[model samples]
Target: MSLRIGQLPDRTPVKLSVSVEPDLACALADYAAIYAETYGAQEKPETLVPVMLEMFLSSDAGFKRARKALHARASKGDT
Candidate 1:
């Protein structure tokens, strides 16, 4: 029997810990404030970090090429 709905992708969340310098911490807070002002929605710097990282990674050409090569190697079962 075929169903219209497909199996959902993994939604498990992973927690990460990072340390930043005081200046960078202050900058992140300022960025969060500007983000809230620009979008009229309040978001914590922690909440924005993953999204900002994803955006940066998606926009990086070298990372994209390297990621593609890595995926190809993985698919070929290369170490």
Candidate 2:
């Protein structure tokens, strides 16, 4: 018997707004800057956020674990 794996369909573009603590935001920016500097790239940190998010979301285990944790937290009314 042969096994087949299905691919995810393309998603529509959506706009999301999120607010982060000032320190967290600064830390993320600093990390991004370091990454860019290490790679000798000129892209701004803001441009890296979506790419990082997509990379994380694209990993099967990472996505599943994140979703499970998020659901569990939501069920606990932690959000």
Index of the highest-lDDT prediction: 1
- Candidate 1 global TM-score: 0.86
- Stretches of candidate 2 above 4 Å error? 1-13, 60-79
- Name the top TM-score candidate: 1
Q: Which run of 10 residues does model 1 get worst, by summed lDDT?
A: 1-10
TM-score (all chains, Cα) for each model: 0.86, 0.50
Residue 33 local lDDT, model 2: 82
lDDT of 1 by residue, 1-79 (tens): 8899998999899999999999999999999999999999999999999999999999999999999999999999995
The residue ranges of model 1 lying beyond 4 angstroms of the native Cα positions read 3-6
- What lDDT does model 2 reach? 0.81
Candidate 2: tens digits of C-alpha lDDT, residues 1-56: 55596666878867677788899789888987898789987666567778888887
Clashing pairs in 1: none
Q: Model 1 misses residue 74 by how many Å?
A: 1.5
